[model samples]
Structures are given as structure tokens and as C-alpha cells.
Target: MTATKLKPTLGTLHLWGLAVGLVISGEYFGWSYGWGTAGTLGFLVSTLLVAVMYTCFIFSYTELTTAIPHAGGPFAYSLRAFGPTGATVAGLATLIEFVFAPPAIAMAIGAYLNVQFPSLSPNVAAVGAYFVFMALNILGVSIAATFELVVTVLAVLELLVFMGVVAPGFSFSRFALGGWAGSDTFSPAAISGIFAAIPFAIWFFLAIEGAAMAAEEAKDPKRTIPRAYIAGILTLVVLALGVMMFAGGVGDWRALSNINDPLPQAMKTVVGDNSAWMHMLVWIGLFGLVASFHGIILGYSRQFFALARAGFLPPALAKLSRFQTPHRAIIAGGVVGIAAVLSDGAVNLQGMGLTAAMITMSVFGAIVMYIMSMLSLFKLRRSEPQLERTYRAPGYPLIPGIALALALVCLVAMVWFNPTITVIFVVLMVLGAVFSKLVRGRGAIDPQLATEV
Candidate 1:
């Protein structure tokens, strides 16, 4: 079967919008959960460290993205460098990262809407969000990307507005009050808290790499992908710091530490629950969640399309609509996300809320992808020195080396702190491997197509 090609409608700006839009929701929720585990200061330390890791990782990852320029992202690079097994692992990890994130974002959207309409159940609203965004995605890639750009701009502006509204009430004393809630300075427990906080810190920049998944759809990808990746990371770092400082400093950080709508809750300290700003925040905050929810659905559809097109997943998922979008893949992914939402609502396993558990699982997948992608970069550099390249990772050995070390640290920390989710991730990987082997036995995958861009 011939591979289905994605429409090259996305430019650097669209890529930037998708990159930032894919992660802007992090500013609104999830990161605060770190405060619960590590306190304000410990989480801050973790965030800074994770931020550095992302900066280095993005710089290094872009080299593969630009050179390969495939919709599969890390999967394509790993396949080229490592082979079928490596591609399966990389593809499965990509699935975990992209597939698991939407349910969490959907839950956040539900939570945000619930703040306004107390009558609406969060689960119902979350399911509703999945339907709306998935349909929008099926319409077309250009339409979906344009929508991502618009909502992303609105989301960024809203965060700035939030900071401006809460600027007067920002108290350094309040921020420092719980900076070391559960641990002493440099104590073992403090150190543990910092490590335990890694996943949430990762939450701050998670899925920005999903921008690379749009490579096949990007115009002049070699030039456009790098520009988008660089600009996106810089924008996120600034927003992450600004939101963290201002929100934690507004009042008792503990009050909003684990809440879904931390921004509005923080604003409530200054504006009161009924204030116009609070109402505006509750409404506008949904845009942030929508931006990510919609963008990630876009990301995952392409991932599913890539995997299916390569025969790693069922070929039906590779089918494109008349609009030249992966409509089937979008719908398939939505089904999985909806199932996740319903399952979490029913079980509430590990005593962690649906959003938190999903985030943990997603971060686990991201760490695995990071490790594999960096290794692929190192392997390809040595073996394929003569391959055509429009861009090269700056700091070469040093930058990717730092990214690999940090990713290893994060993986170990995750296993130590989130044993259950780690186990789940491992099981998922094993199952994916089994399935891949079965598919391979049937002679489903085209070896040449699997490794080529």
C-alpha cells in the first residue's frame, strides 16, 4: 500500500502555534500538584531543572526532526537508527505520550467549565470536549492548525491578564510561607520531594515535542520546525516562571496547590469569588484547555496515522478523509481518550485523581520517548554521517548528552516515586511489543517504508 501523505499547509507560525498550543494548558493546571508533593520552593527547583532539560532536549531533537521530517516524530528517527524493535518501542511511547494526555486535558476542561456551571458534571463536560475537538480535527489540518493558533494567542493573553489582575495582591511573604512545607533545606526528604516533583515539573513542558509530529504537514520543515521548536520552548519557559511566581505569591499557596483551576482560585484570593475578573478567568481559562486539548488531538491523530501507515498499528487508522486529514485516526484516538475518562471516573485508582494519574502516565511515556530519541540521535550521528542534513543540533555531544543524563534521572525518579504508573507503563510497552511481533509475523509492515521518511 502506498503511504498516505499529509498536506503541507503549516508554516513556521502555525508550527509555533501548535507547539505552544499543545502545552499552554500546563500553565493552568497540573504544575500546582507539584506544590502539594514538593512545596513551592522544591517544585520551583525541580521546574528550573526540568526547564533546562527541555531546552537542551528540544535543541538536540530538532536535528532529527528537521532531517527526517516525518509525521512519526521520534518513531521515524528510532526506526531509521535502531530498527523494528526500536521503532515499536518509540512508537508505543509516542502513543502513550500523545494518547494519554487528552483525557487529562479534557478533565481539566470539564473542571474549568464546572466552575462556571455547577450543574454540569465534570466527566460529562470532559466527554463533550472530546467530541467537539475530535470533530473539529477531522475537518482538515489547515483548519485545525488555524484554530490552534487563534486559541493559543487568546490563551497566552489570558495568562498575562491573570498576572496583571493579581499583581497587586502578590505577596513575597505569602509565597515564602510554604516554600518548604514538608522538608528541611537539603534534607533527604527535601531531596526526595524534589525528585518526586520531576513529573509535575515535566508537566510544565510536556507535549511541546508533539510539534515535531506535525513535520510532514509543515512547509519547508527543515527551516520551519527548528524555528517553531526554539521559539516555543522560550515562550513556555517565560510563561511557566511567570505563572508559578505570581500564582504562588498571591495568597496561601497551599489553598490552590492541588486544585484543577489554580489560576481562578488564586485570583479569588484577591478578587473574591464573584468578581468580574474571577468570572472572566473561569471562562477564558477554558480556552487554554481547549487549545491543548484540540492541539494534542491533532498531534495524536498524526501519530496514529504514522504508526498505522507503517503497519505498527492497524492499517485502517492510516485512512485519510476527502479533506486530506486522518479522520479515522482522530476518531480512533478519541474513543481511547473517552474510555480513559470513563475508566478513571469509575475507578479513581491509586487514590490519585483522574487528571493526576493520567499526567503521571503521560509523563512516563514522555521520559521513555526522550531516552529513546536521544539515543537515536547519538546512533544516527555515528552511523549515518553522510546523510543529508539542513540543520544540526548545536552543542552536539554535549547538549544531547545532558538531555540523556537528565532523562535517565527522571526515569529513575519516576520509578522510585510513581511505582504503580511505572509498572503500568512497562506492561503497556510489553503488550505493544507483543502486538508488533504478531503484526510483523503477518508480513504487514513494509520494511523500506517503516524506516524511510
Candidate 2:
């Protein structure tokens, strides 16, 4: 049999999958797990801040993507913008984030699937889903992309139901939120509670900037990218915050905390014990979870495949499919994810499974790269002013500058409270730095790529 590589164009299903994946994994499941129903208001406010910040960043990335449409997103951009050393470090950190993310998300899917569908064993369901994800990758990007669109629509519709009709029925005045203030559950509740509950506030908006990674596959790098980015982000926010607020208004903080899955439990109170609606709503939530995991797996596999192709990881990990997709890399990435899930399932490991730390590090790494990329922009303007730009950042220095500063602050805040994880981030940085140099001579990115800007 002969082989073939699938040629994908911009603004396709694969592109949509990349963006929608970020929103669901970043917002829907991430927030619900961290902040709980009672913290809806606070979580929403923080998320709004993140959303606005990331939206601007996405625009900046869109401009970059249009200028250079390729598979390796930040790595490609950073190398062009920054010098070799700088870009290499950024790429490594990004690779870490994308690689580790699959397991964390897969684990979450396992937990939630168990919660909603008690019939299937969690491990079996998780392992099955992981394999299914691998198969989906092999089925080709066309099928995967279509699934992304369907999943995205389902997630959005579910949110509308929760917020539009159900949320407004309850009184917001009755909600009490003094729990974090006056409570005395001193046993790891303060730090761990925030870390544990951090899902609500932190995970809600994890890797939104990853949308730019799929810019090459987007319909129109200039138009579809920005519009879809705005619409997609807004859709998630309205759903997550809206449903959360509905849940909060329907019941008090005490009631919300007691229920692990706040959305369904809260809906039951508002709907007057309607088991049918609860079951339907809970099933939708699970569907959203599945969609999210699907999206995350896509991102991780693309990253792994992309990095491997670029010569960062092993060459065997970089092989492409007859369909032009990175089949071997995707399968390898899925296996790693399955392993993480299998181990956790056996040991009963819980609480977002290194997600908190992974997110913290990824965001921090991205912020650092953003700062470097911005600086690289200036360097490019000075060093290679005549270079062509397909899409220029609207407010080059100003907008990029603000993004850099905000990212720095976010990174700083994460480090302030998360020393344990911060140290590990340091170790990853050192290790990635070393690894980048190892591939520099032959397989790694050409130093000239960085200077091309």
C-alpha cells in the first residue's frame, strides 16, 4: 500500500477543535473544579480579567500567525521574534505544558464520567476514551474537526439552558459567601483549599492562547481567527459564569459546597426535584467533559507531533500519517495520557492531578515567552526592518508591552503562593534548556530561524 499526507487548509474543523478545546478545558471544567458554585462571582470576575487579557494576546498571536502560518505555533513565532536561545527555551516550556496537559484533563474526564455514569468503571471508561481519542486522530483531521464543531455546539447549548431559563428563577440575595472568611477548617483547607478549589478560579481559563497554534488550519488567519476567537471565548464565559451564577442564586454556599457537581445539584433545587431535567442536564455536563477531553487531546498530540517534527523529541515520535497528520506522535501522546489515567485510577489519586501545577507553570512559561517575543519584535524591527509581515499587530509595541507586563504579574502571583510547584518549574526550565541545546546541531531548530525576523 502507498502513503499519503492530508493537506489541511485554514479555518477548518481542526482549527475550530484547537480553539474550542482551550475554552472547554480552560473554562468549563477548569473553573467548576476550582471555585465551586458559591465562588461563582469571584471566579467570574477573575476569569473576565484573564479573558480580556488573553483576548488581546490572541489578537497579537493572530497577527503573528497570519505573518507565519505553520504547525509549531509559539515556537515558530518566538524563534522569529526572539533569538535562538530565547525561542528554544520558550518552545521547551510550551512543549512541557502541552505534553502534561493531556493526562490532567484525561484524569478529570475519568472522575466526572464516574460521577455522571456510575455504571461504567472509571478506569475502563478513561482507558477506553483515551484509546478512542487515538483512533479519532487516525480517522484523520476531517473527522476530528467535525467532531470538534459538534462538541462545541453541544457545550454551548448546554450552557444556554442553564443560564437563560433556569438561572434567573432564583434570588441572588439569599446566597451567603462568608465561608472563605470566617471559617476555621484549618487542616490544609486554607492553602490546599485554594489549591484544591483553584479549579474554579484558575483552570477556568487555562491555555486560551493555544488557539493561535491552529492558525495555519484556520479558515482565514485574519478574519476567522479573530472573530471565532471572540465568539468562542464569549460563549464559554457566558455559559460557565451564567450557569455558575444560576447555581449560586438558586441555593446558598452551604448547599453548593456539599454537592461535588454543583451544576446538577443546584439545578435540582431550582427545577423542583425534576429528575428528568437533572438527568438531562447532568448528561450534558458529562458530554461537555468528553468534548473538552477530546479537544485537549488534540492540542497535546499536535504539540507533541509538532515538536517532534521540529526535532525536539525523538524522530520516531515525529512521523506523520499517510493522511499527513502525525499518527505515530499522536498515538504515543495518547499512550502517555492513558498511562497517567491508569496509574491515577489504580492509586485513587485525585484533585486535578498535577493540573494546578502544570497550569501554573504553563501560564508562567507563556508569560515569560510573551515578554521575550515582544522584545524579539523590537529586535526584529531593529535588525530586520524590511521583513514582510502578512499581519502586523495593531499596536505593535504598546499592545504587546501591556500583554507582557500582565503575563509577568500573573506568573509572579502564581509563584508567590506556589513555591513547591515553582521549584519544579525551575527544574523543567533547566532541563528543557539543556535538551534544546542537545538538538541544536542537527535535528533542532536552526539558529538562523530566530534571526529571520
Q: Highest TM-score, which number?
A: 1
Q: Judging by lDDT against the true structure, name the best candidate.
A: 1
CA RMSD per model (angstroms) = 1.2, 4.5
Residue range 1-453, candidate 1, lDDT tens digits: 654888899999999999999999999999999998888888899999999999999999999999899999999999999988898899999899999999999989988999889999999999999999998999998999999999999999999999999999998888877586464768887788999989899999999999999998999999999999999999999999999999999988998877888999999999999999999988888889999999999989988898888878877888898899899999988999999989865755467888899999999999999999999999999999998788898998999999999999999999999888888899999998898778766767675667566
Cα displacement (angstroms), candidate 2, residue 450, comes to 8.5
The CA lDDT at 122 in model 1 is 90
Count of clashing residue pairs in every prediction: 0, 18
Q: For candidate 1, what is the total of clashing residue pairs?
A: 0
Error of 2 at 367 (Å): 4.3
Candidate 2 C-alpha lDDT tens digits along 169-253: 6776644354332143343443334433432354555555566666555666666666666566666556555665666677664
As a TM-score, model 1 comes out at 0.98
Instruction: Identify the runs in model 1 with alpha carbons over 4 angstroms from their true place.
Output: 181-183
TM-score per candidate: 0.98, 0.83
Model 1, C-alpha of 164: deviation from truth (Å): 1.1
